[model samples]
Each structure stands twice: as C-alpha cells, then as structure tokens.
Target: MDITSLGGERAAPFEPTFASAAESYLKHGGEERYLAPIVAYFGDRPLKTIYPFDIKAMAEALYPSQSNATRNRQAVTPARAVLMHGYDRGWCNFIRVRRFKEEKPKRRKPATAVWLHAFSRQCDKDGLEHLAAIVLFMASTGARISEAIALRWDEVDLTARTALLLKTKTSTNSMRYLTDEVARRLRGLKEGNSSTDRVFRYSNRHSVNERIRAVCDRADIPYKPPHTCGRHTFASTAIELGMDVKTTMIAGDWRSSSVFLETYVTPRGTPGRVVADRMNVHDFGDI
Candidate 1:
C-alpha cells in the first residue's frame, strides 16, 4: 500500500494539520456531520500531536453541553476517521483513542395499544391516513421513523414476513419482521404502488411530529411519538410476551443485547411480576 512510488521523488511526507485532516477526512471524505465539531475542538493542532489523552479531554469538554450520543459522534467518530485515514494513507501507524462511556438513558415506556388505536382512529378522523400508517408501522415493527420513511415496497417480503431496511443508522441493511397488523396496513398502502416507490411520502420529521401532536390532542392521550413510545413499546411488549433477547435484537436490528436491554426494554407490571415470581424459587425455603 505504499504511495511513495505514486508521487515519485517529489512526493511530500504525509503530514497534515488537524484542521486540514479534519477537513479532508470529515468534509471532503463524506462524513460531513462531524466536520464542525471536530474543527471546533482541534482545528489548529497538528494531526501527529493528537494523543488518546487529547481525545479524552475533548470528550470531557463535550459532556456539559451535549448528550452522550452527540458527544461521542462529535469527538470520537472524527478522531477515529482521521486516525484510520492516516493509517490507510501509509503515513502513520495505528493510534488508539479512548471514547467516553455513555450512560444509558432511562427507558421510555412504549405507547400502549389503546393509545395507538385511539391515535390511529383520530388520525383517520382528521384525514391523516399517512401519519397513522407511519405510526402503526413503527409500533408494529419497532422501526425508527427514518427507517420507515426510507422503506420501499421492494424491500418488503410479504410471504417471508420480513422487510429489508437499507437506510439504517448502522449503515447496513437489516431484516425486520413484519407483524400481521403491519403487513396488512403496508399491503393496503402499497396497492397499485411500484417497487421503487417510497412506502410513505412525507416532507420531514417536523411535519410528522406536528401531525402526531394534532392526533394526540384529539385522542386525549399523551403525545409521545412512535419514535420514542412506539419503539419502547415494541421492545417492552416483546419481552413481556417472553420473546427471547436474541430474537428481539435481530428483529429490532439492535447491535447488542446490552443495548436492547438498557435502552429499549423497560420492565413493566407483567414482566416485573414474572421476575418476582421467579425470584421466589431462589429464596431459601421461606427464610
């Protein structure tokens, strides 16, 4: 992988300032999301001067102002990108940068089936069929809104009861199961639709949120959108119904069981009772 011969005798050594490297790697290299934050932190420093400790400091600095997800994306992603860039270019050896440990946010309760039914009925009443479909799909599949919006008819396999999600946050296509309810709604929506067509047509998340708020106002239920409540509901319901962790993780496309447990799955009355009943077995004979 030596590039020395590519440039010949006049090739300069591969040394870029942090600003130049960040620009080249984050912006021009196509991960523009991290550009501003990385530049703001170490824009003027030399790339060679950056150490693991510097990354730790950057993460610490981000703690007060940003969420753990945002902080990691800002500080860690760009650093790794730059370091990997240097390695790929044959200019520097591998450098390890420690990322900050993010505290798992408290689990949000999923939207109840009752709430969803009321919301959907309200949406239909208000002529928001599209929004209702979106909510129903997310609640049924545990899909993120982005995943739902990016879905296509071609990705859905009705016979197999699965959908291939190509535009996921993980940058990898995921296969999510389709419930009978969701499949029915999706089938109705896709009637006379082409494979290339998007599943739902919407302007943006903001508009969707507004529509959801209107539906909630009419339904007389709390306005927790499917992104929060729907996903939570999917996980919690799966656990409550005794679906295994691995199965739930695969269906939801969660990378790890720990993440599924800590973030998405919130124990509720039924599961709590079951766990308590199981604990009785471990009790020392009524001691």
Candidate 2:
C-alpha cells in the first residue's frame, strides 16, 4: 500500500551521446584511431538510438572500397566497443554488431632456411651482425619484432637458453627457450653489452624491417616481413621438422590451436615428398 514511499522518486535517465561516450572511452585508454571515424559518422546521436544496422551502414559509407576485415576492424569492432563501454556505465543497452563476412585468405609461405641463410650472409657481408642476430632470434624463438626489440640482456639466460618476452602482443609475459644457434648469437652480443641494455640496438620495428628489406634485396632473396620471416617461419619450420602441434604452440605462445594450425602451420618445401618417397608412387607406365 505504501509502495510509492518505498520506491521514492525515479531518478533521471542516464543518456549519453555517441560522441560523449566515445570521448569517455578514449579517456579511459581506448584506441583513438579506431573511434575517429565512428565519432565523425554518428556525431552527437544518442547512444541508445544507434542500432546494428546503423553501425553497418556507417561502416559501408566510411569504407566503401575497403575489405570486410578492414571494415570490421576499423568500424564495426570499435563502434561495438564504445557502445559496450556506454552499457557498462548504464547510459545504453548492450549491443552486438555482426561482423562482415571475410573470405578465406590464401596461405602465406614462410621464409625457407635457404632464404634465411642468404639473408644472414648478406647482413654479415655488410658488417651488420646485429641485424643477422635479430632475424635469427625471431626465427629461432618465434618472437615478434616488437618482442625481440624489447628484449633486454637481463631477460636472457644463455646458460639456460631461455628469454622472457615482456612486451608480448597477448599482454602476458612469456618464456621462450632459444635454439643453440640463437643462444650462441646472444652470447656474442652479450660480451660488450650491459645486462641493463637491450639485446638489440634497434629502436623500433620499422627500422629493423627496413634493414631486413634492404638486406633481402641485396641478397637477391624474396623479401618477407619480419612476421613471415621470423614467427611464421619458426612455426612452419618447427612443424616441418616433425615437432608436435602442442609443442609448437607452446614454443610460439599461440593460445589458440585453430589459429596456429590454420594460419601458421602451412606446408612448405615439398610437403608430399616424404609421403611420396615412402609410398614409392611412380608414373602409370612405370608401375
């Protein structure tokens, strides 16, 4: 009977415009680049009034010539994140935007051992042992360029053949054991370097990649980016050498087996040769 007194007066509704929500999201450390187009598209629209179709339309209008992956990454994903941030603040209902369909990508070939060898030789010829060591470290340990660049001497244990990856893309520290070759190279670099110093002298990934591209060009080898030459090559080569999927995943710090298998474990260098040799298959006439 006294429900009105019990409930008291209803509070004013919390309504935030998309622009304000996005501004709040950015202030809370959200990526600015992704939210830029979304803000420009929706401007001061109420967060609650935006729908999935509106977001999709925004993506289409903003990125007409871009691929589905680009649209989703730059548009759909960021928009959803901002809306979710708003929902968390009780300014809007939670919303889900279906991503655009992406076609299956063609398999990328990892750098071969021969290609790496040539690349290393060129680096050595140019008196760039540090560059050689960088690629080798990446290829041996499946470290990303950023991880490799961020590695300090103290994080490495040559005796134990392990390095701690502190700046991993996964946002977790990872321990990666080095191959004997990588360990030897690290030892050589350690001689004159302080434990407090970074293992490589490079300041950024772009410079390293540019140096790699230059070396590849001089070596007359096809240039693959650091990701392809290092991490991708490590995974593919490890599996090709008969390392088990689980072991490879652990070594590469791949959290998802499906992603590792589908994206990184591509067959390379006459994959059917071993089977063909074992089966002894021949031409029909010869048979």
Candidate 3:
C-alpha cells in the first residue's frame, strides 16, 4: 500500500467504451455512414479490451464477401478513428489495427477527346445542352460531379474565364479557370438563366448519370460514368498533352501528388514511339 503511494498515485481506471467514443466523434462531425456499422459491432466494449483480431472479425462479419478496400474503409478506418479519439483523451492506450491487404488498383481508361466530341454532339442532338455543358465543365476543369452540380451562375465569370468551387471534397474553396470552349458553353447556357440559378439545373448525381447514360447509348461511345469521363479524363488528357504534374495538380485542385498520379493519371496513346524517337541517337545496322 505504501509502495503504491510512492509509485505515483495509481492511474485512474480507463473504462471508456467504444460507443461513448463513437458518440463523441459524431458530435464533433465525424461521418455517420462510416461509423454506423463500427458502433453497432463494438458497442459498450471497453477501448482497452478491443484488439486487432476483434476488428478483423467484425469486418468479416459485417462484409463477408466485400473487398479489402471496403473492409478498410467501412470497418478499420472508423474503428481506428474512434479509438484514436479515446486515446487522445487519455481514456485508453492507443491500439494499432492492421488494415486488410488490398490488391493493386487497375488503371482507369479515361474518355478520349474524340469520345467527348461525339458525346457532346449527341447531347445537342437530343436537346440536352445542359447535360453537355456539365460534362464539358468537368472534363475541362477536373471538377467532381458533385461540384459541377452545385455550381451557380454567380460563381462563374465568363469574361474572366474562371469559376469558383465553393465546397470541395477536401472541404476547401478552389478557383478553376474555364477553358475557352467551356466558357462558350456557359455563355450559351447563361443567356436564359438568372444569375442566382445553378449553372446545371439537375438536383442530384443520379439524374445526371441517367441522362448521361442515355446520351452515351445514342452516341454509341463506351459508357464511362461521370467521374471516369470527367475528372479522370481531364487529368489523363492534360498529362498526355504535356502539362507538367505540378501545373496539372493546381488546375485540378489536387492536394496530393500521389493520389493524382495513382488514381487519375493513366497512359494514353503510344508514348513508346516518342521515347524511341528521342533515343534514336544509337544506330545498329542489324542485331
């Protein structure tokens, strides 16, 4: 007992539950969709008692056949976030939960300029000028579908050839310059619309995708979703056309170079030919 007093007053019991930590996390504005399943599985369990194996078991139980990426996103991420919250408060010791192994991601094929031209013509033919403008804006500026949907007429400056993105996935405001072609489209779309109105009248991504799918069918072009056709296309096209990585990242508002390179950039056309031509200094008669 005397030794306990000398050992620096015994640490108070760490008894915070996962549920309590989750509640706090949500109160502070953590996304509910990611934390919902996590809270349900680890409800009322003391943070100190939870282990990596328990997290793995929870992921398997919740999403048995789901991919490792899904497991890491839906299970491991939220659980770790909650535990870290608790640890920050000194309610429990930090626990490291290993994420499930993910397979190498496949490179995405972006929509070619030819495909975009075809799609645009079909949209005009189908009386879908608004839809065409939306796609074009995304393809030119690398704006996400959600950002395109939320764009307002006031945010656009046709004379300046710039548009303001008020809310982005990164939770920051960004300013994107409009391409000459995009500015022309916006000018046509703005003629009948009020300054306060949204540039594209669509309310949600689903409706926009549906309209895009129909146009893709009519255009007879391979159907890439809005994301693949728009943001992905912009990054790939910019890089292929000799835009430097840093400049492209700034234009597209990409905060992370790694993410921009890995997720958005994909090889297009015959780069090997360009490389060979550049290295043609060495000549061999016959090998």
Candidate 4:
C-alpha cells in the first residue's frame, strides 16, 4: 500500500491502542503519569518473548531487524531491572509502549506486607472507619483498592458474606468472590454512611493513600503506602494459608499467572513454636 494511493488526511486518527492510550494518559496528567508508564508494558507479542522484560526493545525500540542478529528469546535484562524497581515501588502492571514500532513491557509484581500492616493500623487509629472499610476489604477480599472504592453497596451480600467485584486490578470486569469481612465492613458503612452514597465516597486511589499517610504519622508508623501493598498482603497471606489459588483469585483480583507470589515475600502469620514444658506438640500441629 503506497502512501499516495491512500486517501491520507493529516494522518490516521489516534486510536487509543494500549500504548497510544498510555501516552494520552500521561499527557492528561495527574495520577496517570505514574500509572501510564506502568500500563505501557504489555506488548502484542507472545508474553514469554517479552519476558523477563523488554530491555532490548526499550533500549532500541521493538523493530524486526534483519540486520540485527539477536535471539528472539533474549531476555530484556535492563527492562527486567526496571521492572524490579517499579515492582518495589508498587507499579507492577503491563506498560504499553507509546513509541511507534516498539513493543511494550508487561509488569508482574504484587504489593508487599510491611506497608499493608501500616495502612491497616492507620485506618484503625484515624477515625476513618470509612477508610477502614477499604483497608479491611482489600486485606480480606484480596480486591484491589480501586475495586473496593468503586464498589456499590448493593453489590455486597451480607447474608452470603461476599462482595461482587468487577473492573479491577486485572482489568477484567467479572464477578469476583469477595470475603466475609467485605460484607461485615460494608454493613457497618451502610449503617453510618450518609454522604454521596458510595461507600468510601470521598476516596480516590491517591486521596485514600494521602490520608493513610497522614494517619500513619499520627500513629507513629512510618507512612508509606506502596501502590498496592495492601493487596499484596492479602494475596500473599492467602497463599501462605493454603488458600486454593483458584479460590484465592475469586475475582481475578490477583492474576494467577503473575510473578506476584515471588514478590509476595512476607510472612503471612506467626509460626507456632511448641514449649514442651507447657504444651504438647500435638497442639501446635494437627494430630
């Protein structure tokens, strides 16, 4: 297809391809500047080829070079390194490439635990029980903070002790199995909330975080909310507790295929140590 043969107006309308969308998102500004680059990671190629990370593609765009004799399976070492950095900061998601002809990178990390305990305590102390609903929901349901905030009260089924999850961390809008705590918390919110009517209505991801930070300072906990560390706390704890991977992923909230487990490097709970003088080993272990 020659350029002259085509009815070329100025250029093609910018279809918001993931990459294009990410660029547009960055330009629009706000929370997306942090989010945009992270969203620009996933590419159109087989995911493994894009693995470990797309450092080569990132360093020198994703171009099919006949002259460039590089193995198709080469690992993007630098990009992987960048991904590690991003993961540490809690931006583990696919980042669509904005540059034309370049493949985007994919992110596969989960939140950590140290930050989550801090956030939960912050909620407990701040009188932000409204915010506490969110902290607890994320911790118990393993739902993303976005999903928890966007949740409609009616979506919660107290009788069933499950909250309906949609349009969340995985970007999939499907029914997710939220836990019993989600129900209890929602009920508490319903009893007292009288504002715009969305549970945690004043919440956006950033504001909730900023508020959490303030709460942390007051509580004497170092205030650092790493992107989705709360969610990481939930999933990692779920995994350690022997929760079935499928059941744990009730809402696709946590991608079953991600390296999230590796990054979930937190002890879920205290291991029991038996004292022979006080108790039998059978008490510590299921006899």
Candidate 5:
C-alpha cells in the first residue's frame, strides 16, 4: 500500500520536537513524506476553525455527516502547537501562534497606605529606624527596593525636596520629586552630615532587604515580601487625584506608563454617582 494508506497519517504517533526527526517529518521531501499532502487535504474546499477546542479530539475518526466533516473537532490543534514551538524558539515564521485566548488573570493583594505606615511604625518602634526610612521612601515615592538601598546622601536634595532616583529595575534612568511629607521625613533623618557616605552604609549592601524583612515580622503587617511599595503608593494617590499618564510616566520613568495607568492606576469612581450624580468624565480620566 502507499504511504498515505499506511500508518503515516494522523498525529504520527510521536512528540513534536526541534530535532531533525520532527523537522524532517514536518518537511515536504523525505522518507514517507506525507505531511504536506495531508495538510493540503485539510485545506480542501472549506476550512475549519480550531480555537476554543481541545487537541485530544483530532486523533479520532471523522463524523458520519460528511457535511460537518469540515467542522470536525479542531484538526489544527497539533499543528498550532507545533507552530507555537517554532515561533517561541525563533526557528520559523509561525504567525498563527499569536492567536491566544487570555485566561482569567490571577488577582493580587492591594497595597494600602495604612499597611505601609503600620510597617514603618513597627520598624521605628523596634529601633530599626533606617529600615523604616527605607520603607517610608518606598511607600511614598514608588522607588524600587534596590534603588532605595543604593541611595547616597549627596544624590538627595533636601532643599529641593526630591531624591535623585537614578538606578531602576528597568535599565533606564529616573528621578523622584518626593512628596512633601516623605521628603520632610528623609530630611529630618539623622544620617550624619557627610556627603560622601551612602545613607544606609552601616550595614552590608545585601543586608538592606534582610533588615526590612526582619522589621516587617516585628511590625505585624502582612508579609507578602517588600518591593516597590513606594511606587505602588505614589501611583495609587496620583490616580486618585487624577494626574495625566504622560506626567506619571515622566516622573516614574515607566516605558509604557500609559498602559500601566490603564491597567493599575486608573480611577474606577464615577463622579456623578460619587459626587453630584452626573456621568461626565474627568480631565484626568482619559489620561
């Protein structure tokens, strides 16, 4: 019998891989080369959509109604998976791989001012004031944890009420115009009047995170691990008062701050229902 009549059809009884075995099987010219013809058979007459179905069903036989044979249980699922693999590894053009259905996203715990204040207060009361200051800076400015630890007193301008937030999680430069309250707290800190010393230089460079975690345990606030709390807090308040996304992006140095604003920092309140019962949008709403 011909190769088409033999066992060369269907899923081919093998896992798809980047190896020559899989590639040769997938290619047009080779021993028992039947993939191209089979694919053409699938594209014959009318085509069927494969999305929103499981690939397991494609291994079975076609249905009784030849009319609905074109609408069989997703014959393209295995091919789609193979295409995605190729696309992921940068081996070939697999454009159909981009057609992904987004699953229900996991929810995250809301970071609040009360929680941060409580965490900082715990640190202060426990005599770990430096770590508390770090927490304060994080909660108010939305600066990254690493950036806060790398801070030198010289980079901070107490007169200008701003911290020269230079290093960032993203490989980009940024500056923080600290909120008045947070700036005042930083200015009043008795970090010795030495311009050359790092602000938290007494401890090892790695120990900044260590002491923050230890203090968090002492403070009794939720221990979800410390990071970018100040950034979160700053974004939260700016969203509440209605700051433009462009302004926020410039201040925070976010590459796509507009996208972040829409996803994380957009206000969900209705002014009409919230204040005077009108359905008009605020100027910052589009921001």
Candidate 6:
C-alpha cells in the first residue's frame, strides 16, 4: 500500500500555522482593521496550541486599556474568527470563545429643542452645509446615521413624499413617509449631485460625528453620542406634536413600540400636571 493511502481519511495537503491562518482570513475576509491586534496576540503560535485560557488572558489584558464592549468586539470576535478558520481547515480542534456582556447606560434626558436650535445655528455659522443637512435629515426623519449616510437620490421621491430606505434591520422598512422639510433638505443636497451619488458626502461616520462634537462644543451643549440627539429629538418632537405612539414607531422604524417608549419618550414640562386641569374645568357640569 502507498504511504499516502494508508488511512481511509486523506488529510489536508498543507495545514497552516495559527498566524498564517489568521492572516489568510483577514486578507480574504476583508476586515483589515483587526490585523495588527490579532497578530500581536497570536504571534507565531501554531494552530493547535491555543487554549481557552489564552483567550481569557487576552480578554483580561485588553480590559485594562479598552472598554469591555471594544475588547469583545474588536479583539475577541476577530480572535475567535482566526481560530475558527484554522479549525475549518482541519489544522485545529474547535475552540469556543466567550464574549463579554456590555450593558450601556440609560439617557436621563433626550435631546431638547434648545440643543437643536443652538447646534443648527452653529452649523450655519461654520458654513458646514453638508453637516447641517445631515443634522436636519436625522432630526426630521428619526433616521439612523447609517441609513441617512447610505441614502441615494434615486431612493428619494419628493413628489410622492416617500423614500425607499435601504439597509434597515427589517426588510419591511424599504418605504417610509417623509416630512416636507426632510424632502426639502434632500432636494437641496441633490442640486448638483447625480442620482447615483450618496446624499451626504461624509466619508465616514466618525468624520460626521467629529463635526457634530465640534458644533456641540461651540454651542455649549452637552455632547451625547453623535446621533443620540437626532434620534430622540425626532421621537420626542413627534410625541409633543400629538402623534400617536404607533405612528411614531412606524416613523422611527422601530420594531416594537415598547423600545420606542422606553428609549425616546419622556414626560414633558406640564403634560402630567395639566392632565386633570382640563378634565375638571372644561366639563365640570357633565361630571
């Protein structure tokens, strides 16, 4: 019998080392951002040598310098991917990595009218029309920053007052109604750009967020996360305008009204105090 055919199973011709497998995955998988850190963690270790303790140590090491969320997302997720790649290629056994639990803090107050006015005025003063338009679009539509950035001219229908939004979590959200101001701002941005062009020229979410932060600093507003204000502002404003919760949920592309209520809605200045004000005085004779 030939040596190669000794066993019933034929092994892979070439088994990659741990580092090489990771490099291959990062190159072909197209997540180059994690390359440096993955290489630093794994070094020249062979595919079969890594253990769960090593993964735990790496997670613990990352916690001192990075948030638990970032540690798990950036380091742990990619590290697991590298291991999985090696396992799939028959170079190593399966190693399951545990991810960290990341619980975010709740917001005490949503973005208010005062912040919006101040931020918009600052954007106008800075002549950041693109940033201004983005702010306006988010404020009016309750759109996620990702959704707004990915919007194309072809998706906007000014005449019909509708927009075919792409990349929403649910495929059911392709069509959304647009406010006149939202439509107008979109038209303004589209004046010189082609239908195929993105509505905003923002190269990345970070750049847009940086601009918002700068405006917040200049306007003396407390900095919330980039789109926090816009998302909450749209919901709160709609509620204040007497829009029903169901309608507001649809407008915000929220899957559930409970999340919309918990995250976005808050008691206004005197809505609660005045609840019985009209009830007792306006119809006193009937009651």
Per-residue alpha-carbon lDDT of candidate 4 for residues 1-287, written as tens digits (9 for 90 to 100): 76657876456643323343334334544233233233455533322234333544543444355223232222233234344444343445555333223343333244445555565566766568777667766666666677767877666666767666655555666565546655665677787545336666755788888786777677675554534445665766677667776766663355654555454434433445423433663565665
- Rate residue 90 of model 5 by lDDT: 50
TM-score of 1: 0.72
Poorly placed runs, candidate 4 (over 4 Å):
1-125, 174-182, 192-196, 224-229, 250-252, 265-287
- Candidate 1's displacement at residue 278, Å, is 5.6
Give me the displacement of residue 103 in model 4, in angstroms.
19
Question: Model 5: how large is the Cα RMSD against the reference?
Answer: 13.0
Please identify which of the two predictions, 2 or 5, would achieve the higher TM-score against the true structure: 2
- Judged by lDDT relative to the true structure, which candidate is superior, 2 or 6? 2
lDDT of each: 0.76, 0.89, 0.89, 0.54, 0.56, 0.77
CA error at residue 65 for candidate 4, angstroms: 26
User: Which prediction has more favorable lDDT, 3 or 5?
Assistant: 3
lDDT winner between 1 and 3, please give it.
Answer: 3
Residue 116, model 5: Cα distance from true site in angstroms: 2.8
Say what the RMSD of model 4 is: 12.9
**Residues 157-257 of candidate 2: C-alpha lDDT, one tens digit per residue:** 99899999995888899999988887887788888788889898898999998998899889998988899999999999999888999999998889999
What digit string (tens of lDDT, one per residue) describes model 5 on residues 109-216?
A: 435767777877887688776766776776666676677777788888878877776657776666777677667667667456577666655344357667766766
Clashing pairs in 2: none
Candidates ranked by TM-score: 3, 2, 1, 6, 5, 4
Q: Measured by C-alpha RMSD in angstroms, how accurate is candidate 6?
A: 6.0
Global local distance difference test of model 6: 0.77
Number of the top TM-score candidate:
3
**What TM-score, computed on C-alpha atoms, does each candidate reach?**
0.72, 0.82, 0.87, 0.50, 0.53, 0.63
In model 6, pairs of residues that clash are: none
Worst 10 residues of 5 by lDDT: 44-53
Q: Which ten residues in a row have the lowest lDDT in candidate 6?
A: 7-16
Instruction: Give me the overall lDDT of model 3.
Output: 0.89
